[model samples]
Target chain A: DQQVKQNSPSLSVQEGRISILNCDYTNSMFDYFLWYKKYPAEGPTFLISISSIKDKNEDGRFTVFLNKSAKHLSLHIVPSQPGDSAVYFCAAYPNYGGVTNKLIFGTGTLLAVQP
Target chain B: AAGVIQSPRHLIKEKRETATLKCYPIPRHDTVYWYQQGPGQDPQFLISFYEKMQSDKGSIPDRFSAQQFSDYHSELNMSSLELGDSALYFCASSSLGGGRSDTQYFGPGTRLTVL
Candidate 1:
């Protein structure tokens, strides 16, 4: 079953505007959430993350807000630049089965920033 | 800064052949994870290792096997390769014990194509 979902497959935004990407998870046991951005032929790169203990985490121009009750989280990039265009994947880490953490990923959202 | 390293960024093999993918974690990183991503799909977890031991398992096929060495490097071995095995394989590393190393660092993926 798909535990994590990113319903919007694509998003388009103007440069210097706000870019928001959303993700939802069905597994409440997930304790850590992260966002990764990927370009064609490249591995996904880390963007931002928030632990379930907190509602929000900010890294400079990027902010991630998590709503635990809603089982949803979103990444907001302000003053979005054209270079920010890429496919973004939302991943959740579930510390289950007494093993190391395993990440569950969503289908990803493609962001196109028009300059 | 050091980043995760992967070898043979691209590989082509015939059906029934075997292929080996290698990953070298960043210095002092102790955890390794493997993921496979197909066209238009999210990365799926295969397995993870902690301190040279198997820590978690995911949707890995029976024909596939993996191990982490004492040096903190990991290798994925695929046997009886099939066309369906074509995908981008990524190796991610995390320190897991301390610091921002909790965040996983992904290497440039290896693209494996089986004909």
Candidate 2:
């Protein structure tokens, strides 16, 4: 069972536009959510995260909005740049079973920021 | 101050052979985790360790096992690998026992090819 899901396999957006990536989770036990970006042949880099207690978290040009009631979260990048083109993954930290903050990840969304 | 470091960036193994991947977590970090990513897929949770103890193992086959020592190093062993085992294996680490507030840093990943 895939606890986390990213339905959109790929997204294309023009530079200077806002790019939004969405994720949904079936497990209500998850309390911490994070986004990671991956480039070819590299490990995923931490992007942004939000706790269930908060609705939104922003860092400079990137923002993460969490809707706890909907079990959904999204990452928004304003004025997208070509450097932003990469595979983005949404992951969740499930506290169930005392798992030591292990993450459950979605299939990932490939974002292509066209210049 | 090197983040997570994984050895043997790429490996090719024949079916039924044993494969071992090594990881050196960040200095002073006490938690280590393993994940697997298939082609065009998001990373999948495998297992996690804290202070040399197995904390969690998520949906991994019995053939897969892990060991952590000295709080800064870990290894994942796959015995009698199958074709399906071919994928990019990543190692991640976090400080402070990887609690809700700690963020994980991932290694560049070890690409395994099972023939």
Candidate 3:
């Protein structure tokens, strides 16, 4: 069963605009959520993350909003640059306490910023 | 500024051969996770380790095995490799004691092609 899903496969936006990517998950056991950006032939790079305790987290130009009741999360990149074009994956894991373990990932969304 | 490091960025192997993929976690990070991504597919969790011990398991095949060493480096060993094993393997690390404990930093993936 696919616990995490990113319904949108691709998105296009003009440079300097705001790009929003969404993700949904079925597993309520997950307490930590993160977004990763991946380029062709490269591994995913860490973006922003939000714990279930909070509704939003921001880092630089990237912001992630989580809605626990909806089981949905989104990554927003403002002033999107052409270099921001890449595939974005949403991942999560249950952190009961001490150490965290495996991560379940969504099907990823490809965002293209047109200059 | 250091990130996770993966060895043998590209590997070509024949069916029935064996392949070993290595991952070195970032300094002071205590967790390592392995994931596989096939063509047109989202990344699937494989396995993970914490402080040199097996922490969790995922969809890893019986032909595959992995371990973490004292130095915090991990290896995924695939025996009797099959063509279906061809994919991009990624290693990610996270620190449980840091402020960004929930975020995982990924390395440049290793591309394995089996003929």
Candidate 4:
């Protein structure tokens, strides 16, 4: 089963604008969420994350908001740059077990920032 | 200051053969995990090893096994490989054992092709 889902397979936004990528999870046990950005032929790099205790977390140009009631989370990038164009993956971890933190990832959304 | 390192960047194996992929976690990290990414799909967790012990196994088949050594390096072994095993295998390391709060650093990935 796909516990984490990124409904949008691809997204496009203009440079200097805001880009919002959405993710939804069906599992209620998950308490931590993360977003990773990956470039072609390279490993995925961590971008930002939000804990279950907090509704939102911000890191410079990137902000992640979580809504536990809806089981939804989003990553917002302000002033999107061409360099930000890549595949974005949303992952979640369950709180109880040792393996929960291993990360269950979404299908990924390809983002394209137009110059 | 090195990130996760994976060996045999590319491997081509025939059906019924075995393939071994290796990973070296960054210095001082205690947790290591393996993931497989297929075409047009998200990274799927295979297994996790912590402190030279098996922590968790995902949806992978029994043919897949992993081992962790005293030096914190890990190896993934696939026995009797099938054609469906063609994908990119990634190794990641984290400082913490559980929860999504800790970020994982990944290697460039090993592209495995089973003929």
What Cα-based lDDT does every candidate model obtain? 0.91, 0.91, 0.90, 0.91
TM-score of each: 0.96, 0.95, 0.94, 0.96
Clashes of 1: 0
What class would a CAPRI assessor give candidate 3's docking? medium
lDDT of 2 by residue, B6-90 (tens): 9889999999999999999988889999999998777888989988988777768999889998756999999999999999999
| Model 1 agreement with the true structure over B5-97: per-residue lDDT tens digits | 999899999999999999999899999999999988999999888889888788999999999999999999999999999999999999873
Q: In model 3 chain A, which range of ten residues has the least summed lDDT?
A: A94-103
Comparing 3 and 4 by DockQ, which wins?
A: 4
- Candidate 1 structure quality by residue, lDDT tens digits, A1-115: 8999999999999999999999999998888899999999888899998999999999998999999999999999998999999999999878664444567899999999999
Candidate with the greatest DockQ versus the true structure = 2
For residue A39, model 3's alpha carbon misses the true position, in angstroms, by 0.4
True contacts kept of 2: 0.75
Give lDDT for model 2: 0.91
Error of 2 at B36 (Å): 1.0
Reference-based lDDT, residue B54, model 3:
85
Candidate 1 Cα misplacement greater than 4 A, ranges: A97-99, B97-101
Clashes in predicted model 4: 0
Query: Lowest lDDT 10-mer window, candidate 1 chain B?
Result: B96-105
The CA-based lDDT of model 3 is what? 0.90
